[model samples]
Target: MKLLTIENLVRKFSLKVLTGENQLQQTITQSRSHRPGLEFVGHFDFFPTERVQILGRKEITYLHKLSIEERQIRIGNIVKYHPPCFIVTAGQEGLTYLTQYCVEEGIPLLCTNEPQTTSEFITKLDAYMIKTLAPEIAIHGVCVNVYGMGILLRGKSGVGKSETAHTLIGRGHRLVADDIVVLKKLSPRTILGTHDGKTKEFLALRSVGLLNVVRLYGRKAFQDETRIALDIELTKWQKNSLNNELEHEPTFTEYMDVQIPHIEIQLQPGRDVAGLIEAAANNWLLKQQGYSAAEEFMKRLESDSSW
Candidate 1:
């Protein structure tokens, strides 16, 4: 789990501070935001106390309908829950009483200038939180989104991982990460990959020190991140080993607790490694759609006894 703090939200949105400056250090554990409509109506059942409380135009209007004394009591009761923070969107005014209540309870009150409606604010904030708080882990690999499939190139150092990824980019695929790929668990079974912030859009070849992938191949050569769909491991060609034989069942590698389809490629001089990788990606896509050429060939071979 990643750390999401009120301070992070403030910095990302440039929210105006109304009060509770001391509470900026508070953390938000859930990747969801609540609108507090039910809470405002005194319905405390199932209130997401761990999420950021968003007070949008509709909620504020409802508060304005009440007398000052009533509004203060209702808002004060919510503040007592000590939510991670309170975000007032649409830059609405007349929230002084709410601000005072938050200050009294030491709850961070933040306001955004965007003209988004109440529902819009909730949806956007929820999305932002989900992305920022997703579980992440880093690994040594090259990730590329080829034909709408994410292919992760992994192996020992100097095993032509970078060179193969570079070639795939020349074949019109987008490079997601090079050298260091950060994997984020977006859901129970999905993992997203991206380059390290400092090393994005850069690749290292054996002879070449570093090359700007985006600059050399244009902006289309770069992808911020992609859901990892397959893992390809490159290995030095073994003289007599048939490790990549079609008779062998496909294997998988555990990444962030998720099993990714894995393929081992034997590297050798005069071999079209780039083309082979591209074919592997295409074959993975076929398997995803419930088609397997190897299985089909075996079935046909069993059906026909002609030598």
Candidate 2:
């Protein structure tokens, strides 16, 4: 698991430290922050003690409405529980309510002004945390963009993955990554594939050595990332190679728990592997639009009277 510090958070959002300067190293374990309306009303049963707490205008007003004794007891319960930090949104009054409690209790106190609203600021924080806490892993493959469909090309070394990518680039396709692809789960069903920014500028080809793809094919020949829409596994041709029969059932491979459409293309002497990959991308896009060439062929075959 990745841990975030108040130090990083302050830098990310340009937050102002009202207190707890020495506690900048404090870690934030939860992706979401908390606002204390319920806690001000003395509700503490389900309070998330580890989440960063936020104080907006409404929350500060709520604390002021309570008698000082009641407010102290209510807010005191929350501070004693020891949350990661307390953030008072800019333009909110009543810092005394949280600042004193945070300072005395050793909790970090912070404020931000750029995004003034509590809603917008919290949303921004949530977006960053969601991405930072997301599951990620690196895999061996060549990723490319053909016909706007992101394709992940996989095969054993020397099986022509790079060579196929090279051909695709020549045919005006963008190469996302070569050799190493980083896969991140943006959501349950969305797997985003990205490449090293510097490394993506070059394509390593056997014997020919590393070719500068960006220079050779110009700027449009490369992309930093693409959503992995389909996967293609290339293999050396053999007598027992996968049959060319139409697949009525879909095939898939799991990456970050996302089931991406997958297909296997056998490599043969003088065969066009790049063209096949392009066709596979086109086929996948067509399937997404509810049109399948294989299904059409099957329907025609079944409609025929001849056995």
Candidate 3:
């Protein structure tokens, strides 16, 4: 399992480090955030010290109402658990007691760049951590956004997967990634596809060297990420190749255990591979609307038995 370090968190959230600058490299163990409201008043039965501790205006105001000794002692007890870090939300700062205890324990103390409430910041932080820490696997495929559908072009090497995808870009489609696509399983059924940042906006061609996608196609043809909706494989047309057009009942395949609609196209000279992929994306959209072209064709054949 990958962990989110506090240093990256600060950079991501634009957080201002209030204290414990030396412990900025601490890694967050989970996406869950702790308010520690009960722990402030001597209620520490099931305190989750591994989680990121948060303090909002409500908690800060409540602490201010307490006596100096009571506040310092309670904070000391909570800091003894050594949480991954502390986030003071709602723009509240200048906490002498909490800062002292956190610095003594070497816990990174961070504040939001904006004045968002604890609930709001927690919601955003939770989403970020869940996505940033999600397990990912990079597969050898070209990801393209065809007619608003994410289509993964995959097959054996030299099958024109990248070439077909580049042609699709010329057809006004967006390119999510080329050559290598990083797929992160956001959930059991949802997988998002993106490219590695270093090699972004570039494509490799067999005949030509690396082509900058953004330079050739401009920014409209580039996309950072897209939710994968369909997967297509392109294989060289051999003599023993099977015709997939004969029978199609919504084929499917998996990436990182998440299933998506699948199609296999036989690549041959003079074949309109890019157009076929665009059609596949359109067909996938029609399936989402409770319509299947293959099913409709079969119905027509059964009704008009003039064959």
Candidate 4:
């Protein structure tokens, strides 16, 4: 239900407002663009009016070949559809007819530099719109992609979250974010995690200062982004407490209205915390595949006569 407005695009791409300044508040629902060749030819079948109409060299050339009256009638038919906006890529000339019509009809007409080709603009703008429209939130955690699963490790400060993530990266898993993770709700159930520019490929280690994960471990040590599948919280180890019970059931955390599988691990001395995190990730993957060791164990105990 998120909306991307023409004004937002203008600010992001530095677009020139050829016309329809009042219609800058118009919203676009899709991330795709239409060439509008068929619409220009009076063929409205399968026309995507919800997306922006991109006029590149080919479409403008086609219109230039037509008589003024014919071109007006052709382009006029397209204007009747009330598209979100019309973008002229490469700053092509001879768009006065289109621009005037759009201005009079209150349709947004935008122009960009010649170096920005139609395809390049569409691809980049589409991606930007998708990300911009997604619901996002910031989380203090370390996210890593382990065994193709996105694991978000969160805890209080000095809880060994970053150390475990660093260890995981050294073990060949890829780091998605170090301290602050940005989570975008792409769908009702899917959450995508990414980091900001400043701390993307860098991890802050207490003993060694900032470590560039990509440079230290090569490209395989970092992932630009990932879809978060599990959440783990690290806490101090307790002696003979219920929190330390091995028979405790798994937990769930609600994030952006989505229920994520959660785990709580105790931090202690002489413990292989990194390996434990790896095992938790593997167990989460197993549970996703309908394999649960806890449930199997309970079923076996019930079927045994000695139980």
Per-residue accuracy of model 3 over 1-307 as CA lDDT, tens digit each: 3668999889988999989888887778776788998898788888888888888999888888889888888788788888999888888856887888878888888888786778888998887887787779988989988888788999998888889888988999988898889998888988889998876998889989898889998998888998999989898887776655745666789877889888888988898989888877887788789987777889999989977
Query: Model 4 has how many clashing residue pairs?
Result: 0
In candidate 2, what are the lDDT values of residues 1-307, reduced to their tens digit? Answer: 2578889889999998888999999777777878877777778788888888888888877778888889888888888988888888857766786688888998888888684688889988887776666677888889899998789999998899999999999999998898988787878888878775557677899999998888888999998777889888998998774676777477899986789988888999999888888878887788789997877987898889566
Candidate 3, which segments miss by more than 4 Å at Cα?
Answer: 1-3, 37-47, 238-247, 294-307
Tens digit of lDDT per residue, candidate 4, span 201-242? 999988879989989999999999988888989999988653
Poorly placed runs, candidate 4 (over 4 Å): 1-51, 54-74, 77-82, 87-128, 242-250, 302-307
lDDT of each: 0.86, 0.84, 0.85, 0.86
Predicted candidate 1 versus true structure: per-residue lDDT over 114-198, tens digit per residue: 6677777677778788878988888998999998888899999989998888888898998888889999887788988987788
Worst 10 residues of 3 by lDDT: 241-250
Location of the lowest summed lDDT over 10 successive residues in candidate 1: 241-250
- Model 4 poorest ten-residue lDDT run: 241-250
Arrange candidates by TM-score, highest first: which order?
A: 1, 3, 2, 4
The C-alpha local distance difference test score for the whole of candidate 3 amounts to: 0.85
Off by over 4 Å in 1: 243-248, 294-307
Higher TM-score: candidate 2 or 3?
3
